[model samples]
Target: MASIDLAIAGLAIGAIAALSGIGLLVTYRTNGVLNLAQGGIATLIAYVYREMAVVWGLPVWLSAVLALAVLSPGIGVLLERLVFRPLARRRASAAESLVASLGVMVLTLGMCAGIWGLGAQTDTPAVFPNKSVGIGGHHVGVDTISTLIVILVACVSLGLLQSRTKFGRQMRAVVDDRQLAELSSVPADRVAAAGWAFGTTLAGFTGILLAPRVSLSPYSLSLVVLETFAVVVAARLVSLPAAVFAGLAIGILQSELTQFTVNGSLADIYRTLGSNLFVVVLLVLLLAIPNLRELGDAGSAGSFSSRGGQEDTGTVAERSKDLVWRVAGFVMLLAPMLFAPSDLRHAFMVPALALIFLSIVIVTGYSGQVSLGVAGYAGLGALFSLKLASGGMVGIPHLPGLLAILVGAILVAPIGLVTGYPAIRRRGLTLALVTFAVGAVVSRFVFEQPSLAGNLTVNPLYIGGWELGDKSFYVIELLGLGLGMLAVRNLHRGRLGRALLAVRDNTGGAAAVGVDVRNLKLLAFTMSSVVAGLGGALLAYSASSFSSDTFQPIQSLLWFTAVVVFGADSAVGAIVGAAFIVAIDVMAPSGSSTLAVGILALALGWLPGGLASAVRGVIRYVAEQLADQFVAPASPIRGISALAPAALPAGPGAVAPSSVGTKPAVASARASGSTAGVAAADRVAADRGLALTPFGRTLLGLVGGGGTARPTPAPARANGAGPGAAGDIDRHATVGAGDFGSRNHVEGGHR
Candidate 1:
């Protein structure tokens, strides 16, 4: 009977989970967005509701109507119209849309934090009071019954609407082929808008109901909602009923598990699992699921517009010369080491965190794949190192840090491969959800498990015969980062680099060329995860401890956005990105880094390929300008021959003298020199062709060789100079040296 009561009590939580899952599925189905913002939105609305009812003195029902019915849905519709519509129209990659969703999540969280502060709100208004009714020796709370009823209603109504209504058919058509549906005249936008509104309303309702059961703090509530993602994944982002069932089973199972008695370590493990079983389930489901319905053509192509379309006009040799610039950027990273001792100590986080973000760059940037589960890999890396060092398992005693890192990397590689399998067929919002679900699972089950992670201790990496201090450890980090950059460079060059680029650009096209897309994708994921694990090991040592909060799933989201904004494919960019995040946190307020990242990520459309790409462009442009100036012809000789001796040498030699020719001869000698000067002037004019406008060319003719003189046909035609014999001589004298003279003349010298 007591067991039955606990099960009943669990059902209430299950019902709420089911409601959240159902809401997520609806949004994915109708609008094809997984709504990673769901949790953030829910938390935000809950706070709003609490403020309206508890502080603003609004009636409970009125507050609920305003929040759930008006404000929440209104927010969703506004986002769809303003933010998502433009993205959809431009056909943004799924990874980009996922970033946009993260942006929304960050924005909402910041807004909540700004409004209500980070403190917990325990006095949240509950829809149903603490009252119970007894049925067949089992007492159930009214809220529990109401929650179950609400879940049933939502499920049935959604199922009916999707399967039966005209609107449902149109939605299905649009989801199937948006362009085709538009040809069929279905109002896809209106249908999508309706879906967003409906999904958001459900989120608001779920938040209000769940708030009373859990403390209402922005992070905690949001995380709780995230944990329920297991329910959504179990449904494959499709069926409401399936999600509802998964939620209920997880809730009831968790409650039932509490009654079991066990030994201390095992008991702690069980308790943790009991509370977070859904997260474990979610992770397993995400990794195990074969395929998911993708949103549009997202995740199928590389996110960069300049990827293939832009010629590598910048050659590998040319690009390598830019390595000096990258070294300069790296030097900037080390600048902090020169700061005050206290600040220098904090700067150690830059390299360690940069290594972690480089993992993101390798997997997402280089491969054109999206990974939001990096934190999971990092946490696992930390966990493995701790466990190996402490010798927790049988027959395995404490190990050295270097050995622990190798083992940790090896362990994480398989996990990456496992996750990569799902990624091959899933993309965009589907992949984002899947990866996020995996992170949540690792966080709840592995990180939170006392038996696994609670008592684990991390040891420092050792080299031959020396213990590392903070500065020495930083040096080690630098070496690791150097190796990481080498690996990334290798990945981005040669056959492997081309193959990854091929896969990223066009999977089908790449496979057609026998590129083995699947193997390459798996290889990238494995390598990336191993690097991430090493970074995680470093991060643990830097902190000198392992805490669950250090590897929260939200951190993964933040890391992903940072890498994307910094330039996904650039290792140097990854380092700069890490430094930027660390510097912001050190210099500004705590949450300001996220705020800055959010704003920059929102500007992704304008800054294409992120800030790294923009910086590369600026550098490239400057380099080109410098190259042009270095190779450009020396300035045209002007106003120099005017001060020269008359009848200058025709071609660097004295003119011949003749008697009949002497009189007419010196006349022709002078004429020949003028023609020579005019021809030189023409050559100079053509050399400056790039700078000349049609108007400038006309002006050049008006400033003809010399004033008030004309050259006759003999020498003038021979030199390809027209009928301005005297004018040509005057122009030559007006300019330095003859127009056709050698370029090595003085600024105003005719010699």
Candidate 2:
């Protein structure tokens, strides 16, 4: 009877989790994007439901229907059209789409916080009666009964929708190949829209159902919903039944664990297990699942994108741009020191945050690994620093803050190396989930547990028996920042940098070309963690106390979004992003930076490579424009100097007359279909300012487009010209509709 009561207790919650899991799986299966924003969407829809039903006094059923059928799906359709459609059209990688979804997550959370003031709501309205009913001489909550029925209906309905509908077939086509489906006139956009609509409607329903059971806050409710990611992961992001079963099993297991108890630290640990069973299950499943059957792994680079910078020609431009960025960043770092102690104290977060951002740059930007658990490493670093400074760890003496930070950061490197093992095999979304699980587990089992991270105080810094002032300590921070920059630069420059870039671009190709992909990835993770730990240590020391809230799993997501939106590939960009965050906290409203980051991230489709690449391109374009104003332009016929010493023009984009034939000679040349015709055409081409340089001719010859430069054979004489007929190509080609004649004759004729 007690076990039956526990199962009944868990039933409603489990059903809610299944609902969210189903939405996540369906979105991934149909849209080819795992909606990282599902939690955000869930949280938002939950709030909307509470607002209408509880606050506005609307009927619960009416609110539920409006939220689930209208508002939630409307939000999804809008996002699909605005945020995701462009990405799909351009064939964005799963990694890029995940980042875009992060943008959405960040944006949605920001909206909730801005509107709801970040407080928890306990008065959420429930659609079903909370009272239990007697069934077969056993008690079962009406809500549980209703929810179980809803889950059954959802699963069977979704199964039929996918297997027994025209839209479902279209959705499958879009998921398999969006471009191919579009080419086949399948209306990929509409199919995608429908998929998102269904997914978000389910999300809305789940949010509404779960709201009454949990304290509803932007972060709390979102984390609760995201915890159900374990259910989907257990399904390997595919199976419907697996998600349902796993969600129910874990829920019941958690409820049943409450029946058993122990005393002391073990009791606390046991209680935590019961409370966060879902989070722990997520971590376990992610690590133990052998491999995720990623839907679009074939084209996924598993790295943040900067594809918009395709025009970046490596030259002095990069050097010049980097120098300018350094100068500007240095100014921003120094300005904080001039503020009042209170304000300057707040600025303490800047350099440390930059270090954390750089760690992301190293992993995601440099090595092309999706590392979402850096917050956990950062938290561990802070915890380690405290223990080292206070002599909390056995066999170690208390140390100064600086030494503790160094030792703690270095200590985290091995942990990173171990975590790096998964990255060696996984990429993109799989690696992302694994890393996020690591962070969540650490946050729950370590930071949130009093037995692990209680009574942590900021360690003091001293030098030569003297306590450093605010500005001096800031100088030390600057030094550390400089060192991090130097280390990152070393990793991104020369042979090693080339190898990393090679591996980032194409792992198999890099291995084929003899790059040590394994060692390099491990090194990246190791160095990245060290930097993150150092940042975390510094971050803790700068604050009043070491607080777990500072490194919450949600903060990791925000930091990643910030880093990515600013520029994942630029050290200066890391500094810029950190400064932006610190500045927002100091000057703006709460969560403003998050809103800004979300907006920018959602625009990654256009920004490409984040804000950093766009800035570099603008800088280079201006530099080139200025240079062009001062310097002599290059000559098209300049190659003739090397071959024949022919005189050339003084400016670029110019055609030199020395190599071109005169008009009388061009007219004298016969337009025949033999080698003579080829020579005659070449002369005519030069007269028309299409002169082929010696080098161009040679290069063209290699590609079967030699000096002859003949067009492909026109389909049996384009526009119905006779075989062997040759129009006056040069004269008519320079004309209008008449020119179409020469285009046809010359394309069809050999010449």
Give the number of the best model, judged by TM-score: 2
TM-score for all predictions? 0.76, 0.83
lDDT of 2 by residue, 214-261 (tens): 898888888888889999999988889899999999989889988988
lDDT of 1 at 218: 73
Q: Per-residue CA lDDT of candidate 1, range 1-751, in tens?
A: 4788779978988988898888888877877777878888998999999999999999888898899879988988987886676676666656566777777777677677667877889998787878999899778999989888888887788778878899989989877776688789999888888888888888888889989889998777888888888887787767777888899999998888888878866776677777777777776776677666565656543664222122121355336545754886679667865777688778878877988998988888777778888999999887887788777646667777777766876689899898788777765665776777778778877898776677776666677857777777777778777877888887877557756765665566555535677888898888898889888887887888998888988889888888888877777778988888888888866567777887777677556678766776777678778878887755534333432434333443333211011233333544466777544433343332211211111111111211111112122121333443221332221121223433333221123
Question: Which candidate ranks first by lDDT, i.e. highest?
Answer: 2
User: Model 2: residues >4 Å from true position, as ranges?
Assistant: 297-299, 302-315, 635-751
Clashing residue pairs in candidate 2 (N, C-alpha, C atoms within 3 angstroms): 306-609, 633-652, 634-652
Q: After superposition, how far is residue 125 of candidate 2 from its true place, in Å?
A: 2.2
Off by over 4 Å in 1: 1-3, 53-62, 113-120, 155-166, 180-186, 262-265, 304-328, 386-411, 414-431, 456-469, 605-608, 616-751
